[model samples]
Target: MSRGAQVGVATVYRRFPIKEALLTEAFAEERDRTLQLLLDLVRRAQEAGALRRDFVLEDVGLALMANAGIRAQSPEVRAEASRRFAA
Candidate 1:
């Protein structure tokens, strides 16, 4: 992976003791950024009266939990499930 990224393997290993550790950190950082963006959008929606004032991050987390199951479906089913889920 480091070679594909054009970085030295030693440099990658120096920062992350194991490849799994590196992937875990990367995914976590991405998840945090996405959550922040979602929170901002939810806040703006609530301010505009589009979303209920009482809605919270836990509600979004629940929605995400439901959405995760959609990935197990076939592609066509997944697409339809995702559309309905978003709705």
Candidate 2:
């Protein structure tokens, strides 16, 4: 993974300490990116008078929290669940 990222394997191990830690951080970064995109979309929708003015980013955050259980499933199931959840 570090090689693909053009980073040294030793540096990756040193930063993450464990594989689980690396996975956790990667998941967090991905989640953050998703949330940012959602926020931007929400803002654009609101500006366009599509979404309700009362709708907020926290609502999306809460929904993501509720959907967090999908992480416990197998990768294939998780991917499908995520697709459905987003839909």
* Predicted structure with the largest TM-score when compared to the true one: 1
Q: Report the C-alpha lDDT of model 1 over 1-87, residue by residue, as the tens digit.
A: 565778888878998999899999879988999999999999999999998899998998788788887774478888788789877
Candidate 1 Cα outliers beyond 4 Å, as residue runs: 1-6, 67-87
Q: Candidate 1: what lDDT?
A: 0.86
Which ten-residue region of model 1 has the weakest summed lDDT?
A: 65-74
lDDT of 2 at 45: 95
Candidate 2 lDDT over residue span 1-87, tens digit each:
455788988889889999999999879988899888989999999999988889899888776886786774488888788889766
Question: lDDT per model, in order?
Answer: 0.86, 0.84
Which residue segments of model 2 deviate by more than 4 Å?
A: 1-11, 61-87
Decoy 2 TM-score against native = 0.49
Error in Å for residue 7 of model 1: 3.7
TM-score of each: 0.57, 0.49
